[model samples]
Structure formats: structure tokens, C-alpha cells
Target: MRDIPVVLSGYKLTVVEPPAPNTRDDGNGGQVVVTDRQGVTQFVVALFAKLRVGPGERAPKGEEIKVTLLTDPGLGFEEDSRVELVDPRINAYQIDSPDGRSISGISFKAMGLKPVRAPREEK
Candidate 1:
């Protein structure tokens, strides 16, 4: 199975859920970080974001969608922080299921996130 390309955004991007440290196992006794071909490790952050349905799709506003972000070191986002994802895409991986079945799992990845700039307070 493959991950369907998903572009999730919103006018009011609130966090309904939060992200946790996502880890993986290696063949060795020790665990490993999820990195790219360049060996750059990416931190995983998962959360449910309240967003409106993007163009080309018919959906209601304020639709909540689960978004996963894989970022480089020193990148972290907070709950209810308004932000935008750059070039976000989905990654689908085939995993072994408990019922002896192969299944496709989905996660989201992006170049990074930029905080939506708030209006400058008139001092």
C-alpha cells in the first residue's frame, strides 16, 4: 500500500492532539533514529489539526485531520500554535499486522513549519 498525497491546512489551525517521540528498532540491540539517506535524523511530531478542506475536495470547514511532521533537530512545535507546513507530503509504509496481514500505514512529512505571523501590536 502507498500513502495518498494529502495537503492539510486550515484557517484556524488548532491542535486537538499532540505529538510524541516516534522511535524505531534496528536489527541490532539498540534502537535508531529515523533519518534520511544523508543520515540526518528527523524528529517525529504527530497531532490532529483543525483545518478546512483544501481545494479540489468537497468537505466542510474546521475539519480535523491527523498530521504528522518529521523535522530536523532543534525543531519543535507547541499545542495550539498557528503554523504552516511547507511542501508537506505523506509517507506510506507497509507494516506487518497482528492478524498475519500486511497493511499500509500513513504518516505526514514536511520540509518544516513556519509560524503564522501575528499582527504587530501597535505599541
Candidate 2:
């Protein structure tokens, strides 16, 4: 897997879904929370991102991305709130299934996320 660094400065990110525990099916009809290599629980946060563009430029495109976090995002990340990802990165993966089908795509991950604060009006 190749890890790629992501630059988010050109995009505006809005929370679509709050942070939730990432889980996987435990073999025996049970769900288990996923954790990172450091034993920190992983969380998934869905965000809607729109590219910032100047006037007359191509219409800013938008996409929804789910980011995996190695730690809890604490508080203040309510739905629809503007946020920024901390230490965001992407990984490319390819898995070949037994049926000769290939699955491949990029996955997003981050250390955490924080709510974006509005700038105060200067006096």
C-alpha cells in the first residue's frame, strides 16, 4: 500500500455525519470495534468537500469522503459544522478476490478533526 499525503487547503469541508466508532464483524455473529496499531479505537467521520474556486472558474466540484481516525475527536463536531482534518493522508489498495474480481480504491485517514472557528470582526 502506498500512502499519499492530502492537501485540504483548497477545499471546504463540512461534516455530514458525526464521528462514530469504526467496527467490523467479529466472526461469531458479533461486532467488534476496530483499532489502530497503537490500540487506539478508530472512528469514521463523513464529510462533504467542495473545491474553492474563483469566479468564472469551473463550478466547484464536491464529494463526500469518509475519514478514519485513530483517536476520538472529542467534542464540537456537530453535523453540518465546518471542520478541518488533522494529519490527513490517503492510501491506495488493491485486493483480488477469489472470483477473479479486483477491488481497488483510495482510502482516507486522519489523526483527528476539529471544528473550524469563524474569524472575529476586527474593530
Candidate 3:
């Protein structure tokens, strides 16, 4: 699992549906934030995101949604963390955690926009 930096610098956090590519203007998917964790930032990807929901209804509606960058374990999530939902084009989603430490499962079929990574700096 590569470490990808998930940054939330100047992006808005919302649970709206992600904009369609041919619908309107190009929407900003999710942002990448790089923490102090080693080999953790490389797992960041705009195509996928993590959301934390409540445990009341099987399919909760009108519930609060938080979006956060996530890592890929190829099977499930690596940890139980809180995430925020940006962009209005995104529908609803769930996070799958198997090892509870490396990656989470996301239904990317409903997602439209993905975070675009900035160019790396040259030494």
C-alpha cells in the first residue's frame, strides 16, 4: 500500500453529489493532505474518498456526511477514521474496513470527480 498525502487546504467539505464531467463546469473532487505518516501519503487518490455515517437506519438518509482521503488495501479499509464529503456530484457511499489499519472499501461507481494531484518538486 503506497502512502498518499491527503490535503484539505482550500477545498470545501460537503456531502453534495459530485458534478458530472459533461454536466457543468469541471468540479473539484477531493483534496490531498500529507501528514507526518511515512508511506501513508502515497496512497492518496482523488478517485476515491471515505465517509463516516451514523448507525441507525440500514440506509440512512439526510444524515451528516464527512469526506476524507483514504488509502487502498485492495480488499477493505485499514482504519476507522472520520471523512468529509466535498463536491456536490457525489451521491452516497460507505467505507469497508477489513484489517482496520490499511485500506477501506468505497463504491466509486457513483463518484464522478477525483482529486487531481499537483506536480512534484524537483531536487
Candidate 4:
């Protein structure tokens, strides 16, 4: 993880798709604990999306930042909901292909992404 975690301030998740099994397709995916109750099929869902960034403290010009977010049980995110990622972790990963080639980039994962509460006015 990076020393200074990346934060997407004033972000709006336009599309939050359903979670899928971390099949290690990337060759560097993390572990996901899967537990069951009454065959309900519960597992930690890995969510990813391309979000529209709002102009805020971090982002002044406002640009789009695609985020690969992971959350437990998944989340029902409505379109254009103002949200923020809490304690996001970014790690660099390198993958070696079978043809003597490699690819490297940073992978992002947030502890949680929730709706941003309205700022309260000072008395």
C-alpha cells in the first residue's frame, strides 16, 4: 500500500455493478472469505466502476477516475449518488505473461464507499 492513500474527493458513482467472484483472473487478486447461512450463497463481492470526479479539495479541475472497489455483501448504489471512499488502499502489481512479457500498474481497493453526508451549517 502507498504511504499516502489515494482519495477521490466529492466523487459520484454513476454505475456500481454487481460483485463477482475474485477468480484470480488478474493473477494478483486478493483472498475473499466465503461463508454460508442457509444456502443463500454469501461472499465478499469485488466491485469496480468508472466514476465521475467532482471538483473538491483534492480534485479542483474535476476529472473522471476509474476505481476498483471491493465491499462485503456488495452495495446497492443508485446513479449519481455523492459518495466518498474511506481508507482506500493502493498497491502496485506486476504480472508476468507466459510469452516473456510483463505488465504492471496500481490496483485500488477501498475499505468502504458510502454516501457523502451534507455539510452542516455552522451556527
Per-candidate TM equals: 0.57, 0.87, 0.18, 0.49
Q: For candidate 1, write residues 27-114 as lDDT tens digits.
A: 8887876666676666554444654556697645454555545654244457776666666777777888799999876666766566
Clashes of 4: 0
Clashes of each: 0, 0, 41, 0
Q: Write the per-residue lDDT of candidate 4 for residues 7-81, one digit (tens) a residue.
A: 655344333444343333344576543333443333222333344545563433434444444445256544455
Q: Comparing 2 and 3 by lDDT, which wins?
A: 2
Q: After superposition, how far is residue 113 of candidate 4 from its true place, in Å?
A: 1.5
| Candidates sorted on lDDT, descending | 2, 1, 4, 3
Best by TM-score: 2
Q: Write down the lDDT of every candidate, Cα atoms only.
A: 0.60, 0.90, 0.32, 0.51
What tens-digit string does per-residue lDDT give for candidate 3 at 3-72? 2234443332233433212122335765444432564432222222333344562432333333333333
Q: Of 2 and 4, which scores higher on lDDT?
A: 2
Name model 4 segments beyond 4 Å from true.
Answer: 1-4, 10-12, 18-75, 117-123
Minimum summed lDDT over a 10-residue window in model 1 is located at: 67-76
Which stretch of 10 consecutive residues in model 3 shows the poorest summed lDDT? 106-115
Once superposed on the true structure, which residue ranges of model 1 sit more than 4 Å away at CA? 1-5, 15-22, 26-30, 53-76, 118-123
